[model samples]
Target chain A: MLRDITLGQYYQADSVIHKLDPRVKLGTTIIFIISLFVFQGAWGYAVAALFLALVIKLSKVPFQFMVKGMKAIVFLLLITVIFNLFLTPGEPLVTVWKLTITKEGLRMAVFLSIRLGFLIIGSSVMTLTTTPNQLTDGLEKMLKPLNKIKVPVHEIAMMMSIALRFIPILMEETDKIMKAQLARCADFESGNLIKKAKSLVPLLVPLFISAFRRANDLAMAMEARCYRGGDNRTKMKPLHYEKRDYIAYAIVACYVILGIAAGKLMPLLVSGIIQLV
Target chain B: MPIILDKVSHVYGQDTAMAVTALKNVSLVIPDGQFIGLIGHTGSGKSTLVQHLNGLMKATSGSIYFNGEDIDAEGFDKKMLRSKVGLVFQYPEHQLFETDVFADVCFGPKNLGLSKKEVELRAYEALKLVGLEDAYFYQSPFDLSGGQKRRVAIAGVLAMKPEVLVLDEPTAGLDPKGRDEILDQISRLKKETGMTVILVSHSMDDVAKYVERIIVMNKGSVMYDDAPREVFRHYQELEQIGLAAPQVTYIMKDLQDHGYDVSDEATTIEKAKEEIKSWFARLSAVGKGR
Candidate 1:
């Protein structure tokens, strides 16, 4: 059952998006997020949606997987839609009791929901296409300039990579511990909220103890391997940007510009009864 | 009741890139009231196969029958099946959590929604079965020694009154004395309760000492399943598959190679000594006759 966790799970595939430099993917994801906020109209949403679909197709990741990825944030998406639908006031499309659902409110709900959905899917596309090691390599390279500002960028990336590497191992350990508890008849499934939380004591105590033990062992092993911090450390596989990376960056820049222009030209959905006349 | 697995196969993370076939087309019937030993190397699908007995894992394809009834059938309580087929996982002492040993041992019967009186009664009985003292019952389980903690964990499962007990590496990582104690307790439990026991272990000596039948798994299939004596007869084949016969069997085979006329089926130390003594007696008789 723990295998259902999809977050940070990279699907290895031979596709153009998967082949792109991880730095380019990281930068493009950031640009895409900025563009999402800039794009306000249906046309802009269409462009962003089309771009995401193109990326998904290039990555060769299944549509059902993207839908599965979206499942984690479905509750948040629903909340955003409901909040925008009832809370935003304008020319009323429908009214019930004290709540007024306006045309603008409806538009806002759909736009915001789609925007948030696209934002999550687009960022996930980057992670799905890149391995954790490559992602950390890219992050360290991108943050190299921050070294001058004393940000310890390399150390942060190293920690992130280590954490990512241990996630599956830790998950397996947790699954084992849970099964052991279950064998002893620890009922985690039934009972009220308080009772359920109480049941977690058996699971959590062992998990925490084991996690700490693992951390200590990992630290000792790292020290034994002479893993002293980022000073004068040479990487076996250094990050090198290719021509394809530049082209990918240029495409993301153009998409962002088009999104900003679309936002400017699109008719603004005004609030209150100003649009009724 | 016999535990029957019919063409059972288990694929971990099916349909994903990380998918692996842990077990394939494995069929076996563990008859009731038998002490069955499951021997295999790491990742040999021994754990995966045993987990299906009590419904800890559902078969990817095929079926598992507990006492002639489909365990995966609708309305069949897998949890209750779990209580009936108690699994004591490796290093089970790590699962202890209650402030006191009594509360921890009672956890199983409590989950079964038994009355407080019944829970306490079963807990005390289980403690006694594992040879824990009455004073140790109210003390914290974590304060006990490693072997004692393991016994407490076992008692926690035994409190459920399981008919079939499945243990994974019950003696792993224990000192020799501790190991013998645990094995003796299990043997006593079987004799006293008449419960069927399935033990998963890597030690051929342990299996030979206790189990009536041995099942050897390699890769994902059962390579050999027979009486302990019969299985150890194919010593070379077992070694080729990365398993070794019990030390006594190896010694007996060495004696036979040296023309001592010892049987290859001598798997226990007592039997090997007897065989060697008989061979020496015959040798002395021949020398005297000459």
Candidate 2:
């Protein structure tokens, strides 16, 4: 039952977006997030949406699959929407007993909700197209200059890749332990909050113990293979800036520039047209 | 009453690209108190089949009946079914989490809402049934040896007083002595409690010696379901599917081929020894007559 989670999971598909360098995808995702904050007007949102739609279409990861990741953030999204709707002070649209729904509040809630939703979809698109190992490699390459500042970038990257690799393994272990507990008639469902939390003790203890044991085994296995940090490590598949990666960067940069220009210049152009008319 | 599976099929990740048919139109009836061995190579669907016994997994098509009632029927008590069919997973020692052995064994019965007195009593009995001593009862389960920890885990299930015990490769990581000890205890438990025992293992010799019947699985289907001797008769076919009959079966066949006139049906070492002795007795009798 725990297998349905889609967050940060790579969707296997052969498409132009998936074939692009991971560095390009990572940079695009970061720029997209920044652009979401920069783009304030309707025209700006339209441009951002258009660019996002194009990238998602090219990625070939199904639209439904990308939206599945949004389910995890539904609670956070609701809290943000509620806070914006009730707390913002402006000309009231609707009054309900002690609460007033202001026009500005409604607008802020809608705008912020869209921003959060788009932000999640944008980042998930990158993860869906790129594998964890590739993402780590991209991060390491992008942060290579940090090594001069005494940052252990390579070690940090190695740890991240390993952590990502262990996600599914640990998930499977948890599934097994859960079933084992189930076989003993352990009721994980149909309980109050306290009872439910109490029930998890049996499941979690074994899981934590097994996880530590597995980690120990992994460390020993790595040591046995003479893995002495990434000091002199050579890549089996080194990262390179291909033609497609450069093209992707160009497209993303143009989208960000267009979004910023739309937000900055759209109002002036609208008033200028009104004066001329 | 017997547990019956009628044309049961299970497809993992159904309607997806990665879908796999783990069990295909499988049919079987496990009687009330039979020591049945489920033998299959890896990915042969043995584990999937056993999970269906306790309603741990639902079949994609068809149905399973426990004591003549459909287990998947509306309002059927699944928790009761689980307690009735205790599943001891592979590396069961990993399931032990309670601070002490006795407390760990009590986990199952406690879930059943049993009284404190009865829970402790059942735990005590279960520990004794698995041949774990009283001295170790209060000791930490994590501090015990691998075999002892496994026994405590088994007792955890046993305390529920399940009518059928389904153990999946219980001796997988244990040494030879530990393996035999655990298997012997299971065999003894079956005889003493009259509980239906379904031992899922790929090992031919272990099943041949302990189980009264053997079911061979291949590629998500039952390849053979018969007495140990009858099943072992098709050792060549079993080997073709990445499984083999017990070593003694091959030895008995070899003896017959070498003109010893021994019965090739012997599937276990003890049976093979008796057959070879009888063959010698017959040979000396014929020599005296000549």
Per-residue lDDT for A48 in model 1? 87
lDDT of 2 by residue, A164-242 (tens): 9999989999999999999999999878999999999999999999989989999999999999876778999999998
Question: Between which residue pairs do clashes occur in model 2?
Answer: none
The CA lDDT at B105 in model 2 is 95
Off by over 4 Å in 2: A94-99, A270-277, B257-260
iRMS of candidate 2, Å:
0.5
Off by over 4 Å in 1: A94-101, A147-150, A261-277, B15-18, B132-139, B175-177, B257-260
lDDT of candidate 1 over B192-270, digit per residue (tens): 9999999999889887988899999999899999999999999889888888999988887777798767688888888
Docking class of 2: high
How does each model score on TM-score? 0.88, 0.95
Lowest lDDT block of 10, candidate 2 chain A: A226-235
lDDT of 1 by residue, A83-170 (tens): 8999997899999998999998999998888888888898889888999999999999999999999999988999999899989988
TM-score of chain A of 1: 0.92
